[model samples]
Target: MLRAELAGVFRRRRTLGLLAGLAGLPVIAGLALYFSGSSHGHGPVFLDQVTHNGVFLALVGLVVSGQLFLPLAVSVVAGDSIAGEAAVGTLRYILTRPVRRRRLLVSKLVAIVAFAVVAALVVAASGLVTGAVLFPLGRVTTLSGFTIGLPQGVARIAAAAAVVGLSMAGLAAVGLFVSTLTEAPMGAMAATAAVFIVSLVMEGIPQLSILEPYLMTTHWMAFTDLFRVPISWTGIERDLGTQAVWGLLAGLAAWARFGTSDVTS
Candidate 1:
């Protein structure tokens, strides 16, 4: 069933389209920077330096895109999981095949995570390649104003991307739980996205500062701290830990509710 779900996800035109759209982000952003690196009022002023190193492009892509596009792309796939099947009137048929609901739910979660990993890799790979060709490659300067060797920089970029990818797992689990609640994939997608929106809004409100650390999306950009000298693990660890907690808790919630829920199509 996992294999079948994998094939279903990877072979779908809509899934391919989502990935393709994600890949294009690097191209568009890189080109915009390439042609207008010196233009005033164009992206963050700090971003002008990205034109100097390909590694910076990957960081920039992760920083900018991770805020919205990447999460939204993953949300669509995860949010559609069981809900998509139900909307098509195939949920009852699949259940009749003697497959346990838990097994099916596991399959969907696996497929969603696999899809997210691939999407993250694609974004990182495209950003690196595009940045390499358009900019230059060498040691990368960290946000702390310290420079690191090329190899280490590459390693940190990969690690940063990985952590960012893992953060999305929390969002995926939220989407999966939402998927289990409704047959409408669209509603699941919207509800899952609302998690991010609400988090960001809550974070921006000064009154909510005390509660910010608990939101799953709070530590998302913590991956940026990985580029620092000696490899700052505090933020990265906290972010990964927060994401894991959210994913695990949401997965359990979904399982508990879905274990015996009605599945009429």
Candidate 2:
């Protein structure tokens, strides 16, 4: 079932388009920074230092793309998973087969996870290559008030990329649940994106600080801890825990809805 799901999801032109757009971001960012000369001490967090160490480009790309594009890309796939199939009348047929609805949802969710992993790698790989080509690669100065060697920096970049990639999976689950609520894939996409946008906005408000810790997006940037000297696991641990909670709850909701909902298509 998972194999079949992978085959169908990857075969779509939309999937290719999402990956292409993702792969292009690092090129654009890397080029602009490459020609910009000095760091000027400006731009997204950690981005200004890219000229110093190419490995930082990987971190910078994750930071830049994580803003909106990353979630938007995965949401596009997760948002479309079930609703898109139903929109075209294939969902009913699939349900009629021996494939349990829960199993189907699991397969689709797994596929989304696979896509998210690939997307993160694309950003990290492209950014690293572009940064190396355009600037020097060496030891990295980290936010944790310490310096790390080239190999260590690369390890942190890979680890950070993995965490950031998984962080978006919670949103993917949210999108999956939303997809089950409607037959319009675009609607699901918009709704899923709206949830993140709203959480981000609310996260910025001081009055809402009480609710901040519980918000699904609250700990997203905690991946930055990888650059820390002692490597504070406190926030990253909380971040991954929050994402898991969100995904599990959302997945359960999706299963409940899909299992009980009528399929009239």
Candidate 3:
């Protein structure tokens, strides 16, 4: 069942398009930066470093898409997990099989999580290739003012991608829950996207500092810590912990709702 679910998820044109679009992000960014040129201490978080070390493009692309694009993609896929099937009137038939509701939900969630990880890795891989072709490849300077060899730098980029990818699992769970609540995929997608956007906005407000720690987006940029000289895991751990808690709650809620809910199309 899990294998079939994964195959179905990846075989869709929509999934292919999403992955292609994600891959383009780093390529476009690298091309623009290569042509226009960037200086040290200029632009966004990793833009400056991208020119000096091609691998930084992986980080830059992740940062660029972290805010909105990646979330939207995750939301769309997750939102469609159940709702899209229902919208097309196949969910009811799927439920007619011997598959238990809990198992089906689990399969959908796993597929969504897989897509999320692939999405992040696509960006990183694309960035790495594009950056390597367009810029110089060499050692990477840690955010803490220390240098590391290219191999370690690449490994860190891969690690950062994994962190970013796993971070979406929590949102994937939320989106899956939302998908169960409605048959309209667009509605689920929009609501899920709004949740992330609202969390991001609220996290930015000083008055919400007390609530910030609980927000899903609070620790998104924590991947930057991976680039530090000593590689601080505090922020990354907090982010993963936050994501786990959220995913757990949402997954439970989804199981509770989906387990007993009636299927109609």
Candidate 4:
């Protein structure tokens, strides 16, 4: 069941388009910088570093996409998980089969999570390739003002991608819950995206400082800590913990709603 779910999720044209679009960001950025001959410290956070080391493009792509692009992409996939099936009048038919609701729900969640992980890695991988082709690939500088070999730097970038990918778990669960609330995939997608945007907006407000510690977007950028000489785990640990709590709450809510709801479609 899980394998079928994954295959279905990956075989869609929409999924391919999303992945391609993600990979395009890094390639476009690399081309722009390469053609323009930008000097040191002239571009955004990681792009500046990319000028010195191509490996930084991986970090740059993750940062660029993590903000809204990646989350929005996740919203589309996850929001469509259950709702899309229902909209197409397949949810009722599927429920008539021997598959349990719990198992089906689990499968959908796994598919979305898988999509999220692949989406993140796509950004990292494309960035690395583009960066390598456009700029010099060599030693990478750490956030702590130290340098590491190219292989170690690449490993850290891969680690950062994994962390960023897992960071979407909370959003994926929330999207699933929202999906269960409606039959319209667009509605669920919009609502899920709104949740992420609202969280980001609230996190920016001064009065919301107390709530910032729990917002899904709060520790997203903490992946940069991986580039530190000693690698700080405080922010990354808190980020994963927060995601786990959110995922648990949303998953329970989704199960309750899905298990009890009538399947007319």
Candidate with more favorable, higher lDDT: 2 or 4: 4
The 0-to-1 C-alpha lDDT of every candidate, in the order given, reads: 0.84, 0.87, 0.91, 0.91
- What is the Cα-based TM-score of model 2? 0.96
Order of quality (lDDT)? 3, 4, 2, 1
lDDT of 2 by residue, 79-177 (tens): 899999999999988988867999999999989978887888888888889889888998889896689988888888888888888888789899999
lDDT of 4 by residue, 18-40 (tens): 99999999998888888877746
RMSD of each: 1.8, 1.3, 1.1, 1.1
| Model 2 clashing residue pairs (backbone) | none
Alpha carbon lDDT at 119, candidate 3: 91
| Estimated TM-score for each candidate | 0.94, 0.96, 0.97, 0.97
Which of candidates 1 and 2 is the stronger one according to TM-score? Answer: 2
List residue ranges in candidate 3 displaced over 4 A. Answer: none
